[model samples]
Target: MAPFPYLAWVAASTVLVPFASRSETAKLARADVPRSRAREKLGFATGQRDATQPLVWFHAASVGESLSVLALITRIGAALPDTQFLITSGTATSADLIARRMPPRCQHQFAPLDAPGPLRRFLKHWCPDAAIFVESELWPQMLRRTHASGARMALVNARLSTDSVKRWQQMPATARYMLDVFDLILTQNDAMAETIVSLGAPPARVARGINLKSMADPLPVDHAALAEAQTALRNRPVWIASSTHQGEEQSVLKAHQRLLRRWPDLCLILAPRHPARGQEVADLITEAGMSHSRRSAGDAPAGQVFLADTLGELGTWYALSDIVFLGGSLRPIGGHNPFEVAHSGATVLSGTHVTNFAETFSGMEELGAARFVSDAADLAEKVEALFSDTQGREMACAAALEFAQQQTDKLDEIAARLITTLELSA
Candidate 1:
């Protein structure tokens, strides 16, 4: 019933224009979009789009967002028998992660390209009864097409950045269009709730919901690998520079250099968060002239920076370290999940850009379970100081781990809300 902003988004989906010139044979040889399209094609359910069984769709943007929804999916699958799930995401990495974790009744699909044609094909075929988008995935076509199909929509774990709010406020026409799509918006914190209201979503439609990460169980690690890392780290002090961004790696290198001076055998484990960027980080380490080893490349040389360059091994890296610096915060990505660092017994240090994870970080800090650094230099200083005194490091981690353990209950509570809210509609 409201004016929509579907034209610009519709025009932008010319993503397939280049494919028009290439031969199908050539496309297949290059593993091109058509080849990727085949993968997308198989996930479609044409004739049965509106079959008797209820279809609930969950969409997330990437690996982090997809993983966050896992706990909620597991609960939904268990409680609702005969209910099928159609999960969609925009990125390849998100789809891959979901592939590994798909439940019995759930299916993973490439979200229909945001263009009008493909999105129409997608909604016309899938016709999901309820759409659940995680953490602010406000695609106009997906929301409008599905809603127009008479399906209900809700944004679980919704978030809106302050800058994004101000930006959207300037485009009230567009903001109002997308805001109306999310009938219920469960935000992660008060700051996020305020941002949502500013973005034209009414106060009544939004509420602060518990963060999924605080409710996340750490990814399990292989015992053998865990033991090997533990043995290599035996009696030697170690700390993690986790999910570190591009510029932050050089800072960690200098910090490792600084801390190594005090605790001579100190080994710094650098997890760049993006394993694909291992080479870039490796180059930074080399430019800084610190010898390093890639986790993907057999064992890291002793005294060399351990490039924990593999996905799914972050837990192992966190577990083996005594101190943890969850990255993304040092230079304003607002830090990675501190709750994860807290789950493992490690002294957690993050940067001040924690507006995103304010509640989780706040609880950890209140419990004396975590600390913050105002700058990279301060992060370096804190990492060095924590490693210098074993007693202080242990105290910090003990408090953090205990606090993290207390958060397991939040998952069930939030999952319950998702159930009640989604099942309430037509």
Candidate 2:
């Protein structure tokens, strides 16, 4: 029997799911999400599943979570040639990106809502042999129904905050019941492993695993675009502030102002985390009195500031410079992935609030591949030091590249572990 809280949740969701699904579908459609894909959340699948071949279902919450597992899925597919994969994520952004870069034999879909009707139709159609839930996506009904269907399940790259741990600890029976659905729970580090265990996951089932984000395939670089940008810059010293959030852009613009004093022709490629804010960010650059060009407008990197307000071109921007400042850390939004920057052969500079990728940043810092900046002044200072010291900058880039390379070597090991734990092998 399930706990009272779980039972109550099921009862309420059963009554409210229809109305909720309609409301959500309308909201997503208004956001320009295609009506066809939005309806998938209401238990409609866009494709057929092959019942003869074993299928592995991976559910991730958003873009980062979905992309992190692509390499692992490739490795697993190589080992089990007869296996097909189904990846489900909740966001349209993730859906579009995954469609472009999906691994062979894999299909992407919008995850069904965690209600009886959606789950029933989803499970009945897909009939996944094994399910892998990534990070903190512990949808109660999804887990319960999948487990009840006799499909082996594992939670990979698991992480939880102190507050979440406290909340789970307060409902110990519910926590245990939910966690027991997983045959294995692989956490990002030892601390996360301990945290999950404390939440009632079987100690034997919990193990420390590498951060999957570290193993993401390098972002695809458009060679023609890279060449054109490099030629336009004509040897100007460049640094990029990639994935900048709202509050962080002001500091980045200030730092760019400071850099202009020493290196008059230095170009700053500012890519915001959300490109929809291009006009807003352009206003900030203008207020800072910097001549700027917008990438979405097809303007070249001709100004002191280049606003890269486009999607899927981060690789080309990273290739423009060796000094990269990753944002999202300046505020409490956690941090963007540094491995992507490192993989592009650049030195990483970030702020101090990177709780999401704490272990990842610690490793890079230890390798002398990444540095932490406090404010605009500190950011300018660090960027200046890297620009002036050629040897030091090269060493940092080399160290970062080395660190990025080391992560892929662990993918096969992780893939094998998942295979054994989930019994996904033919």
The TM-score of candidate 2 is 0.97
- Model 2 C-alpha lDDT per residue in residues 149-205, reported as the tens digit of each score: 999999999988778888899999999999999999999999889888888899999
- Model 1, position 137, has a per-residue lDDT of 82
Q: Estimate each model's TM-score.
A: 0.84, 0.97
lDDT of 2 at 348: 100
> What is the per-residue lDDT of model 1 for residues 106-199, given as tens digits with 9 covering 90 to 100?
8777665455666666776787878899986887777877788887788988876567677788888788788887767888877788888877
Q: Cα deviation of 265 in candidate 1 (Å)?
A: 2.2
Q: What ranges in model 2 sit over 4 Å off?
A: none
C-alpha root-mean-square deviation, each candidate: 4.0, 1.4
Worst 10 residues of 2 by lDDT: 22-31
Q: How far off is residue 239 in model 2, in Å? A: 0.6
The pairs that clash in candidate 2 are none
Candidate 1 ranges beyond 4 A from true positions: 1-4, 7-52, 101-104, 162-167, 170-174, 375-377, 424-426
For candidate 2, the lDDT comes to 0.92
